[model samples]
Target chain A: MREVVVPLAQRSYTIAIGEGLLDRRDLLAPIVAGRQVAIVSNVTVAPLYAARLRAALEPDADCVIEVALPDGEAHKHWGTLNAIFDALLEHRFDRSAILVALGGGVVGDMTGFAAAVYQRGIDFIQVPTTLLAQVDSSVGGKTGINHPLGKNMIGAFHQPRLVLADVGCLATLPERELSAGLAEVIKHGAIADAAYLDAVERALPALLARDPGALADTVARSCEIKAGVVGSDERESGLRAILNFGHTFGHAIEAGLGYGEWLHGEAVGAGMVMAADLSRRLGLLDAAAAGRLRDAIAAAGLPVRGPAWPADRYVELMSVDKKAERGTPRFVLLEGLGRACVRRAPDDAVRETLAACAPG
Target chain B: MREVVVPLAQRSYTIAIGEGLLDRRDLLAPIVAGRQVAIVSNVTVAPLYAARLRAALEPDADCVIEVALPDGEAHKHWGTLNAIFDALLEHRFDRSAILVALGGGVVGDMTGFAAAVYQRGIDFIQVPTTLLAQVDSSVGGKTGINHPLGKNMIGAFHQPRLVLADVGCLATLPERELSAGLAEVIKHGAIADAAYLDAVERALPALLARDPGALADTVARSCEIKAGVVGSDERESGLRAILNFGHTFGHAIEAGLGYGEWLHGEAVGAGMVMAADLSRRLGLLDAAAAGRLRDAIAAAGLPVRGPAWPADRYVELMSVDKKAERGTPRFVLLEGLGRACVRRAPDDAVRETLAACAPG
Candidate 1:
């Protein structure tokens, strides 16, 4: 077991990475201060882990409620998020009561957001069950639902009391989902640690085979990098924007593809390649470095090429991204391997990159 | 113009209280940093001030979009909040884009909450047009929509960049609406300032008549008290809970009456009396003091008696309040005149107070 603490001043918390953390009653006890607990999960995850998690919480909590939302990115909107609230209010959960997010990114995001707004904010715990979530989303304080026009357009920066990333949960993840999670793991390496990137490249086979040691090492390293970044820039005011390296292009792909068509990690996977391509064209990154990123993403079995939307359509979709400031789209670009910066490329350059990177 | 600065460390902002501040482009210019602006108002307020506010912002902002939701507390829910997001996304409003809330509490709250969740938070300005909003809601960082089960069950603590409390807007307010606004004004006095309470009692006729000077003084003093509390405890972790004095009972009344039946201030007006009754029964407050508080509330033309619901129903409704902890409802009871404390009274005492305060 490896524990990394995100030092966000008073809001700091720990990310516990290990196997079979779901039954770790000692951990579940201290973090959840209240007697009432609500476990928020999606349909797919609830059937798998909700009961075990609930039973773990039962000895401490007087009451344990479960809210199972429909699974998928399409359901990450206001209506679905409200269902969590409806259940909380129905069960009369108070501000001091704890909410445990018991699924992947969708469940974590929605549950975190539901906790953020439920009675003007409550404490919540993240039990992220997916590699993508464990490595990335679960560590950051960002929690929100999607707007139809854009992905992650509605949300808040609500930190969790604890993030229990039970790598054991990943054993049940589908091949495609596992591959998608690698996108973020790869992203953490590409943006901050060359040595970590090399380690990931070398461990691809072990990662694909769900080797416990390899999975744990990868998740812990990813969380350490993320926690370091988040601790410094909790609100993404400056240094944190680097974490969104491929997210601008990734969000466009997700929104352009209508949210669920391309999974978030898949989109981010291809988006990372496009960003690297753009970085190369902008004279910020070498073609060799860009190729290495593309190779690692492809080797992880995630998409390397984004959908061939018209350049204008891509621009239109990207314009609404959260990173856009005063009509100028700011993108996280690689300056080199293990280095990232948020910058606005010339519109023509961005459009040309879209044209160049489109599936041929 | 009286300005109170809410010192929330880095998130601190100024609350400008005066007459006709909506047209003060000088004040609006420095606060609204972004060139792209979206003004969120309700139908009732849009026709009255939307165009004028837009015109004030025209010279500074390149594009100004207005999203007019249907006016009323019933509309302060997810459906209406989604419309704000729809308009923002449709217009491609970015993180740098500013949202200006141009109405009473509902519009200010919805708009502030929209800005809070819009791209994980954006800068927003509050141009509160009602006495209630100007005096209370607009100054505090409490922003959210209500859930079906409870009032303000869904929300965020997102402070505005600037609060433009135009006492002039109150001139056009209906008599009942004006009285309702005074409920919060009275609450501010009852909880923090015996001198302010005396001033409110002395100036009740002028306040009822919508005298601009009286309204300005009342609003400024109320904001001063609220700003002080909010600055110290932005997330309502401790000191800020006192600001919720009467709100637990008030939210129950509002939720019981189906939101729009009684204006928020009116419900709070009656709730304050119930709280005073509870405080008196608890021996924390004298009957004479409680009577004085009730008389002032009545003088404001606000309700002193709430609906005669069963004690169990009130208990059930109040149980879901944000103040509840471990199934025990914490009521913000008066310790003395101009002093308040949150304590869990004997459940029977609460029930008896509810029974006594109910309309016979």
Candidate 2:
């Protein structure tokens, strides 16, 4: 097992990444504060792992309740988030009770958000089942639901008490979902670590093949980078914005295409490519480095080309992104292969990048 | 104007309490950051003060948008909150844009919550018009919408950038609404200060008669106590829970009676009497002190006796209160006249208090 501690002083928590760590009572005991536990999973994950997690927690918890929501990114909204609240209230789960989020990103986000607003705030644990969640969403405290107008427009920065990412859970992830997770893995490397990016490129084949060591290593490294970034700037006041390297464009893509149509990682994968192209256009990143980053993303079975939306349409959508301050859209572009910086791109340069990277 | 600084480190803010402070451009200028500002007021407050606030902010802000929501506690829900988000998105309000809550507690709570969850978080100021809001809700950062199941159940603890309590606005307030605000004023005194409580008791007639000096002093003193409590325990982990002295029973009364039937302060007024009775039963408060507390509540033109809900029903309702932990309802009971302590009352004792305080 590998542990990466997010040093947030009093709100600090640990992300435990390993194979078969789900049922570890020792790992779950310290964080599970109250006797009552509500394991919030989705329909897809509930049928598979909810029972196992419940059994694991049964001995420790006085009342182990399960609320399995309908699965999908489309289900990530007020209605679904309220269902978690309703269940918590129905079961008489109090502030001291722990809410265990036991699914993928959608589940984790909604559960974390539910915990954030449930009775002002409650302790919650993230048990991410997919690689996308394990490496990205579960580590950071950015939990929220999407609005009709914008993705993640409504949410809170509520950190979890503990995050348990079982590498073995990845065995069940769909191939596309696994690839989607790699999009964030590649993002972590593309933003901060060149050696990690090189390692990811070398381990692509093994990672796709579900090699336990490669998956564990990748998850641990991604979480470490994320934990480090999140630790320094918990509220995204400055340095933390780098983590959204591809997210502005990715969010626009997700919102434009409709939330559930393209998985978050898929949009991020394509968005990263567009961002690199924009970086190259701005003379911040050399063409060869941008090309290499695209190659790595593609090698991980992720998309390099964005959808053929008009440049103006993309601009319009991106302008509404959360990263956009005042009226200017802030893009997290690569300074080189391994470093990211937030910059406002010229309209023509953004247009050129859109024109170059859009699908023919 | 009197300023009470809530010393919450970087998130610290001030409550500026005075008469006619709303139209003072000097007070609103420093806190209202960003060019774009949205004044979230209700239908009632729109005609009254929104224009004055907009006129004051116009000199500093480039764009001042007004969103007038339907007024009342019933309107404090997701639909209304989403409307704020929709307007923000439609108008393209960014993270840097400011949302000024220009109404009563409902407006302040919803607007603060909207700011909290809007684009992860944004800055908001509270221009509390009602005494309930000016003295209480606007000072602390307890912003949220109510759920169908509970009051203030779905929300975030997002503090305002500034709180402007214009004592002059109280001139237009309904007599009942003015009295409702007094409940919170009484609560601050009952929980923290004996002298403040005595002053409130003595100033009841003048306060009810809308004596500006008396009202300002009362609001300033109440805010001072609240600012101190909130600064020490921002997240309600320990000392802050004392601020909810009457709130546990108050919330149940509000929820049980169907929100809006009785104003929040009215419920809290009766709830405080019940809490005092329970404290006396626990031997923490003397019967004479409890009676004096009830007498003061009545003197403030607030309800001292609660509606006759069966004891079991009160127990059931209070059990689901956010303050309840691990299936036990935590009551913030008065220790004699001034100090407050959080304690779990025996079920029968709580039942007795309910029976004693319930209307015959």
Candidate 3:
């Protein structure tokens, strides 16, 4: 198993990565605090692991409330958040009580946001049932619900008490979902670790085949890079924005295409491609290097081009993204592989890249 | 003008207590960072001081979005919180933007909660226009909206960058409103300062008349006591609950009174009498001391008897209060004058207190 501490002092928590860590009583025990725990999962993940999780927590859980919300990123809304609160209030949970998030990013993010706002804030443990949440959303304290107008437009950075990411769960995720998670993994490597990028480049097929050892290492390394950045900038003030390497264009695509229709990882995958193309268009990246990024990303079976979003629609959507300032879209770009900066991608440059990135 | 710092180190901010301090450039200058500032106020407050405050902020505020919400505690809900986010997104506010809260506890609490959750978290300044908000809600970082099931049930301890308590604003306040503010002032004296309680007993009429210096000193002293407790325990983990003084029974009264029926202060005024009477019954206070507490509160023209609420309803209403645990209503009882502790009041004590406090 691999462990990463988020270093937030009192709010500091550990993210455990390995096969079958979900059943480990030691890790989940120290965090849940109470005898009663609410395992907040979604419809998709409840039947799969809820029983095993309940068994694992059965040793200590005095009373358990298993709340299974409907699965899908689209379900990460205010209504879902309210449902979690309702469950907590109905069961009479206290400050000492805890909520266990038992699914992927949507479940984790929505559950965490609910925990953040329920009774001002409460304790919650992140059990990232999907590869995407394990390596990304589950680690950071960024808990929020999405607004109708934009992606992740509402929330708070309330850190979790514990994160138990069992690699075994990834076996249940669809191939496309696995590929989607790889976008974030690839992002961590591209922005902070060239060698990891090289490793993923070499091991794309094996990693895609769901090798447990490789899976643990990739998720852990991604978390390490992210943990370091988040420890310094928990709220995404500066260095943290770099972690959103593809997110600028990614969020725009997600909003433009309509949220939940496209997976967050998929949007980020395509957003990374546009960013690479844009970096090359600005001459900040070598054509070969840019093509290598595109090649590596494409080799992993991810999108190398954004959707057929129009220049104006994409512009309008990007203008509402959290990073925008005075209608200028903020893009986190590569200074080179393993180096990044957050700045506005000039209109002319963005337009040129969009034109170049068009399907031939 | 007197200044009290909550002393939260890097997140530390000052609570400036003075008459006319809201118009003081020096006080507002250090806090106003971003050009696009949103003043989250209500309909009542906006018409009263929004323009004057706007004129003062012209030098600092680049773009001001004044959100005039429906006034009263009933409006302090997630719907109101959503409105703040809607305005921010509509204006495309960046992370650097600051939120200025210009009203009583309701507006201050809701705006602070919005700022805390808006875009993960943003800096906010509290321009508390009500006596209640100025001396109480503005000082504590307890920003949240009320739930249908509870009061201030969902929130965070996200402190403000600056708290501007303009004593001059009290000049335009209604007699009932000013009396309501005095409930919190009385609470400070009851929980932490015997001398201040004595001073409040002597100066109720002058305070009611809105004597500027007396009001300023009273506000400053109340702020100092609150800041001390909060600095030591920002989250109401312990010690800080003392700052809640009459709030245990007080909040129950407000909740039973349908939240907006009785002003928070009016409920608290009656609650203080109940708490003092409960304290005496518990043998922690003398009847003479209790009489003084009740007499001073009555002299301010505030109610000292419980509202026309059934015991069963009060029980159900207070179960949802943040201070309650496992359906046990935790009361801040007086160990002696100006000293308090959170203890589970015996059922007999609460029932008898309610029976004795009936308006009849």
Candidate 4:
């Protein structure tokens, strides 16, 4: 077992990574013991894990409540988020109640948000069951639902009490979803660590093949990298924007193709390639480095190209992204293999990159 | 002009109380300069003051957008909040956008909440038109919409950059509404300063007659008392709960009668009386003190008696209040002329107070 602490002062909590941690009553008890506990998950992940998680929580929890939302990114809106509130209110859960998020990114995001706004604010624990969530979504305190105008357009910076990343749950993740998770894992290396990127490239087969050792190592490293960035810039005022290295373009891809058509990480996977290409075109990154990043993304079985859409349409979608400031979309481009910076590229350069990356 | 600074560290803001502060460009410029400004007002208040507020903001703001929502607490739900988001997104307002809440408590709350969640969080200025908002809601960082189950069941504690409390706007306030505002003003005195409560009782006629001096004095004192409480306990962990002196029962009154049937302050007015009666029954307060508080409420033209509801129903509603812990309703009872404490009362005593205070 490996534990990484996200140092967020009073809001800090540990991310525990290992196999079969879900059944570890010893680990779950301290957080849920004698407290009203609500386990929020989606239909897909809840059926597989909710009961076991409930079994572990029922022993010490004052009472256990289960709220299973509809599955998929398309449901990540106000209407779906309200279901959690409806259940909590129906059960008459008070401020002292604790919510445990027990699914992937979609579940984690919605559950975290529900906890953030429920009775002004309350405590919540993250038990991420997907690779994408374990490394990225579960670490940062960013919790919200998507607006029709843009993805993650509404949210709060509410940190969790604890994050339990049980690797055993990853066995249930579909093949394509696992690759999508790797997009963020790959992002962790691409934005901050060159040696880690090489390690990921070499361990690609082992990670894809569900090797426990490889999966655990990458999740820990990715968490540490993200926690460090989030700790320094908790509100994303400055250094935190680097974490969105590919998100500006990735959000455009998701919105353009209509959400849920491609997984978020899948969109991010292709978005990173386009960002690197843009970096190279501006002479900030070499062709060799850009190509290397694309090869690793492709080898991980994630898309390296977006849906064929006009450059103007992609630009239009990107302009509405949360990362955009005053209608101008700011791109997060890599100056090198291990360094990322946020800035606005020339209109022509952005258009050319979009046209070249996703040829219609 | 009187300014009280809410000392909340980085989230600290000033509540500027005076007549005609709404048209003060010097005060509004620093916050709105070079930023997209969204003036969120209700249909009732917009036709009255939104144009004047917008005119003052146009010189410094990049652009000023007006969003007139349906008025009243009945509309303080997800649908109304979505309208604010819709307008902001429609105009492509970015993270740097500043939301100006130009109405009473309902507008202030929804606008503050809209600013809190829009693009995660953004800057907002409170331009409270109603005396109720100026004295209470505008000073607190609490922002959220009501859920079907409970009032303020969903929200975030996102403080504003500035709070502009224009006493001039109170001139257009209805007689009942002005009296409703006095309920909170009386609460501040009842919970924190006995002398302030005495002053309010003496000045009731002047306050009712719309005397600018008396109104300004009460507003400033109310802001100071509320600010002191909020600064110490921003998340309502301990001391802040005292500030909800009558809110537990008040919220029940609003929910029980159906929201918008009785104004929030009117319910709070009657709730305060019931709470005082409960305190007296609990042996924490004397009959004379309770009567004095009730008389002040009555003198201010606010309700001193609640609607005749079954004791069990009120008990059940209070049990779901945010202040309740572990399904037990914690009462904020007054111990003396100007003292408050939170604890669970004997069920019999609570029932007795309800019967004595509100007779069908």
Q: What is candidate 4's local distance difference test score?
A: 0.90
What tens-digit string does per-residue lDDT give for candidate 3 at B1-360?
Answer: 788887888889888877777677666766674478888899998998888777677687667778889988778888878888899888878788899999988888899989888888889999888788878887769988876656676888788998888888998898888989898898899889999999988888789889999898898888888888888988778998787677777787776666778888888888888888888889888999899888888988899898766666666767767677777788888878888877788888877787788532
Name the runs in model 2 displaced over 4 angstroms: B248-252, B308-317, B326-330, B346-356
TM-score of 2: 0.95
Candidate 4 chain B TM? 0.98
Error of 3 at A281 (Å): 3.4
DockQ for the candidate 3 complex?
Answer: 0.72
Candidate 3, TM-score of its B chain: 0.94
The superposed Cα distance between candidate 4 and the true structure at residue A138, in angstroms, equals 1.1
lDDT over C-alpha atoms for residue B194 of model 1:
85
lDDT tens digits, residue span B84-183, model 1 = 9999888877777899999998999999999989989999999999888888888768898877776677888888988888889988999888998888
Evaluate every candidate with DockQ and list the scores.
Answer: 0.72, 0.69, 0.72, 0.80
Model 1 residue A236 CA deviation in Å: 2.0
Clashing residue pairs, candidate 3?
A35-A62, A120-B155, B191-B338
Tell me each candidate's TM-score. Answer: 0.94, 0.95, 0.95, 0.97
Candidate 4 residues lying further than 4 Å off, grouped into runs, are none
Name the top lDDT candidate.
Answer: 4
Who wins the TM-score comparison?
Answer: 4
**Better TM-score candidate (1, 2):** 2
Question: C-alpha displacement of B163 in model 4, angstroms?
Answer: 0.6
